[model samples]
Target: MTRRVALGVTGAASAAVMSGCGSSEAGAGGNVKQPEISSPIDMAATQDVPVGGVIKANSGDVTVMISQPAEGTFKAFSSACTHQGCTVNAQNNNIVCPCHSSNFTIEDGSVTGGPAEEPLPQYPVKVDGGRIIVG
Candidate 1:
């Protein structure tokens, strides 16, 4: 009976560790919440977004990545990684997810590499009088 109990406990511990190894959570036991945006959000001035650069913004419960690939052009996409729903936290020429190393293109949010199979969800955005509006 003692040997059986020890084996059972070891198996359970191993299963618990394995379960967390593939979790998509950004941080801390998969407790990260997906941000939600129900209404249009005004993010920042157009001038603040540099050409060939990107910016991350959170509005109303949703996190978004905005990119200006060139002059007079802007695009927006969800900051969540499609692979495991982890929030993307890093950006270079592409948006990056720290949780799984997924990289997405700044132009259209398409998966460039890593484990993500789909592109980041896109949101409609417009430049209104120097303000960046996303919905």
Candidate 2:
């Protein structure tokens, strides 16, 4: 009986530890579906994205990250991380995946470090009347 109790306790402890190892954050579970945008998305005003900075826009079905590497020059990419299909949730000058710590450059979505072998998929973006439009 004592042996059986010890086994049960060990199993419960193992399950608890394993559960904590995975992220509960959205898009971090690897199975989370990436948002898909079929139509042009109005992301933000050109002035909202500072030079050398990035902004994330969610348009119901898709998430896009827009970055301005230089004044009046705008670029866009899918927010999904290339490492494990996790959506990037953090950013500074770089996009960061909260799942496995993958980091990507905002200039062209190139991988900087942390297990991502491919760059984030790029999208076309343009500015019209000071609004950033992405498709």
Candidate 3:
């Protein structure tokens, strides 16, 4: 009986740990109230990003690139490469896809380098308080 109870508890603990993996969204666990899922999800902090700098942020499951072109001016685009949907990274003044060297302008998501003909989809972004909110 003791061994059966120990196994049951161990299995429950393992299940709990596995369930929490690979998710950033707040969960409605028991008495805790989950945050409302709104259209404009709160993204990165404004102070962490500098003028002419870019940062990668997650809006739920979608990955977005947030750029500061000038002081108080911000822009965001889908980080997925237009060529093959691989996630792109911030490289200097351009967003580059390591998969195929596809480069896009930070100011606007226009493709500056080849292999990708279409530009990254830009997201409407605005600064509120110290956070950059994206929809």
TM-score of every prediction relative to native? 0.76, 0.80, 0.69
Best by lDDT: 2
Model 1 stretches astray by more than 4 angstroms: 1-36
Per-residue alpha-carbon lDDT of candidate 1 for residues 1-135, written as tens digits (9 for 90 to 100): 699999999999999988875675544224344456677889878987889888887655666888998888999888767887777764666798776688998889898899989998888898899999998
Which of the predicted structures, 2 or 3, would earn the higher TM-score when compared with the native?
2
What is the alpha-carbon lDDT for the whole of candidate 2?
A: 0.79
Q: Write the per-residue lDDT of candidate 2 for residues 1-135, one digit (tens) a residue.
A: 699999999999999977754655665545445456577788889988889988887666677888899888999987877776777864777788887798888889898889889988888887889998887
Model 1 scores worst on lDDT over the 10 consecutive residues at 25-34
- By lDDT, highest first, what's the ranking? 2, 1, 3
Per-prediction tally of clashes: 2, 1, 0
Error of 2 at 3 (Å): 6.9
CA RMSD, predictions in order? 3.5, 2.7, 11.0
Q: Which prediction has more favorable lDDT, 1 or 3?
A: 1
Model 3 TM-score, 2 decimals = 0.69
The weakest ten consecutive residues by lDDT in model 2 span: 27-36
